[model samples]
Target: MSTPNRVYLARLAGVAVFDPNGDQVGRVRDAVARMRATQRPPEVVGLVAEMPMRRRIFLSINRITSIDPDGVVLGSGTLNLRRFEKRPNELLVLQELLDRRVQLDSGHAGSVVDVAMECSRGGEWALSRVAVREHTGRLTRRGHLHQVDWDRVHGLGAVGDNRGTANLLAVLEDMRPADLANALQDLPDARRNEVAAALDDERLADVLSELPEHDQVEILAALDRQRAADVLEEMEPDDAADLLNELPPPEQDVLLDLMEPDEADPVRQLLRYASGTAGSVMTSEPVILPPDATVAEALARIREPQLSPAVAAQVFVTRAPLTTPTGRYLGMVHFQRLLREPPADLLGGIVVNDIDPLRTSTPLPEITRRMATYDMVSMPVVDRNNRLVGAVTVDDVLDHSLPRDWRDRDAVSPSSATHDGILDGDDE
Candidate 1:
């Protein structure tokens, strides 16, 4: 038979798969590939399908008889593929990848959507992290087309097997920190701490920030004083301060000592602020530029791969000796504005000082009101000295204060409360 055109899994995103006689099987939910134990092209392991009634099923690649751009051709007739079940000593299917974060070859990052299972050559069923999908569109179209092998999985957590429950604690004992952090989120608090305690300072720090404050406290309390301090020091100052606030004074003091003076000082300052304050939430890590810098220079800095979106968005403009330490606050230039203007224009020319700014101490209500009033995505937080301290975006405020259901529940009312009631009884 002639080989069909090389159709990529990405291009087949919305395509359908059919049986040999051309009966519809299912739509292609996702294509999965597994890394070979030895050096070899990762084999297409299976395809996840969105079946009828919102049900999902996995079809093994071995059952595929042909491939075409239009749809996948399966060798089997229309039959529901059997789901792999976890047996004694077998890895849990769902636990292996469910909710654990993964990096796709395409540079997009996301947690596992679901795992695909199939029976291996020896008549035993196997589970693997086959498909990864991201919620964000950070990676471009070309980047999204690439696929990675399961072996390339840099990190993973102790996920349960196909069974509802398994001994994940034992599996977590040997995993790395980031992987453990990803996995611990789904585990009970007790098991999560057990896995956290085994992580190194850096890994613990990374994982701690990803967890909720309650979990952070639980894990921190379980760690030895020295290890806990080391982890706090490695974390961002704001994050460290947040965690420290949850600890008792004596423990907090000891952890502070473990951090370098430079790292400890800023964190201590942040700790002094109230929770939910801009000062407590903001990172001092921002890009500062002088008003004299050409739009070209600012654009270059923003475009650099090293700078993150948050840092790149608001470019601060200062006075001429571009590096003038005491230059008066000019204004902020947004990326959208910068992109619209010529690169050669001076940043000062584009500066708009009339913008609304927020004080570090501003309450959530006021901050939200200002955001809504100005129709702003983010507002810069500054101190009494007019020095930029942090920023609060609309998302940050809404995450805390926005009503889940703001629509009027009482909008629908009875037409009459008195006379109509009696009239209805008489009208039959």
Candidate 2:
């Protein structure tokens, strides 16, 4: 490869990645480096590129024809579609290192601004330079910028209480909640908490739901009681209930008490049901409308950007009260059916109640069987009084059915792993 002797990894973020034929494949997300046992600088692994559909895959540095500020050209088009998972001893350059608090060999406190990787004469790449900005301790003036050898920096190998997250969060701002969660799982525990803590309540709530249960519990615990309650309030009630279920009753109650009465009420109700039942896994906030609502109104409600695809796939129609515990559950209408109906038509005239709704106490196995038989993405759950209470989506069923710790499944050790991840890119 013909490239500059040194490349700043942070600047490469969002640079387009292309096939040899000049077709765009993805954009640079971050650089991966394998930490060394000795004082030697970490060896540069490859670039994590965000492909079409927000799928991130690894591209070996060896496959690159050239590298610059513009774009990365890949020698091969064949690519692995498997999701990228981080292995121990592997550091994500932008996510884990940037905005890190560090001290210079001269003992000046500063924070990492960027990192540069240099190519060796033998063709191997390694992180070799550090760009840091000194803490001016003055609000009127910006800090002094320093570009020094990687070895001249201290505190880069560990987390500090004063680390800044504004730069790191900026790089992650455009990512989807699930993608951001994957990136967070790759960070050191303390760094992960620091970054997660920096996100606003709504963003953190979205990311927390995507994270593994243990990670969710850990990040939530890292926050103060009031802030934790606020984040939980922003999450979907079912997700908030699911996360709270992981904590002991006393801890759960404390956070619940801190949440607003309206938000806490639905979650408290969800918590009342036994695990493995419909009520326990259903989302209390799925798209809901009254029977007298028009097709256009139902369409508009489903179009709300905050609604999950599964939740928005259909609209549950009921009588009177539109919220959970709504009066007289009246069935539902799929968005597809809505598209076929006149905008002025009332939902009550064409609702599909053919499939029976799951009762709160119904077992998950039965629910899954029925959903599969009916090809439904989501199914309504009601109370004995025939009032709409919640809706169980396919994702909820899968979450409960998967083995605990599935998110932490084993990956090939860093020592043995080839290009792309635990598995070789070619094989995957």
Candidate 3:
């Protein structure tokens, strides 16, 4: 067989560094690239050592002669260096990162357990986020932690550097609402609810909307009426409607009554549509711009703070008259299409008229068929009068279609076929 490809130094950053004899030589720290005179790839340059005071040592990429699942073997018998340099402003050491807190963002937190490096990113390297395991109680219980890519990490800070007495909850509390929501998904139900209750109305709303339907129900059921109402008010109308539809009729009515009229009205309107129909599933929160508006103007409108959070996808351009009580139905303007075209292009010119709008009364199966045929992720819902009602996302359809028989699998007899003889013999 031909010689295998030699793994580069940059790819070996987080790889377990070992001596030629297979003795562990600490993990590869960070890969450093030095600019070269020619346009060729940067030299393997140096390695930020994971051990011996987290020192930085220079090593040639050619030094890494082999790689295996177990560890890496250096071409040289041992890594020898005359001198090493300390990374300027480097506060974290590999030992410290092993069990220390790294703030993913202001609201999200996790303990660093291991760093992973992508061997394929040429010479580039990245830090991988891993959940820290902690022991508790007299029994010395341990729990699993989540792993997230470092790219998703918005910020990083050190927590509990001294010892194993870190407060995970306090660190998690500092993360942003969005990041916190993501982090909480990995928490236990009781702990998740506790964290949800601890957040303010806005943060609670974010977390609730981000949650899976079952978890959302649990959190909402646990919240007081006022808090539930506040969260519902903050949610997109379609999302609010879907959430309310899951609740008991009495509980739903109570929460609806507590919400502001403006906030509750859209949800009520959405509820009038059939459960899987476009109107019932559509979000009333789309960014609607007049047909006459230029791309620049539409962009400006999108940038405005007053726009709903639901408008992140696209700006729906309707005939100015259509926005009124008697306005007629018009086409749509997707954000991607808008960005690709010239800025001077009129919103009307860029409107995609081929999109098929769905009626509130349309059957869900038919809607699903159309979605599959068109490969559309979301479709607008309208009423008999062509009034924009709500939007249905592909995810909503998939969620609805997912079989509820998940628990039924456990009820099945594992040996049903083989047990038939036993049953018959017993009857005899």
Q: lDDT ranking from best to worst?
A: 2, 1, 3
On lDDT, the leading prediction is 2
Q: Which regions of candidate 1 are displaced past 4 Å? A: 1-182, 188-191, 194-204, 303-308, 319-327, 398-428
TM-score (all chains, Cα) for each model: 0.52, 0.83, 0.52
lDDT of 1 by residue, 306-425 (tens): 444655776777544332122455678888898899989998889877975677777777877887887776677767766666566554565446342221111112221211111223
In angstroms, how far off is 250's CA in candidate 1?
2.7
What lDDT would each prediction earn against the true structure?
0.58, 0.87, 0.57
Clashes of each: 7, 0, 10
| Candidate topping TM-score | 2
Taking the tens digit of each residue's C-alpha lDDT, what string does model 2 give over 1-428?
Answer: 86799999988987888888998888899998989999999999788887764556777777788888889888854665566666779888888788889889988888888999999999999999999989999989888899999999987777456568988887788877977887787677988898999999999999998888899999999999999999999999999999999999999999999999999999999999999999999999888888889999999999999888999999998887888899898889999999999999999999999889999999999999999999999999999999999999999998888776655413212232334533343531
- Cα displacement (angstroms), candidate 2, residue 105, comes to 9.0
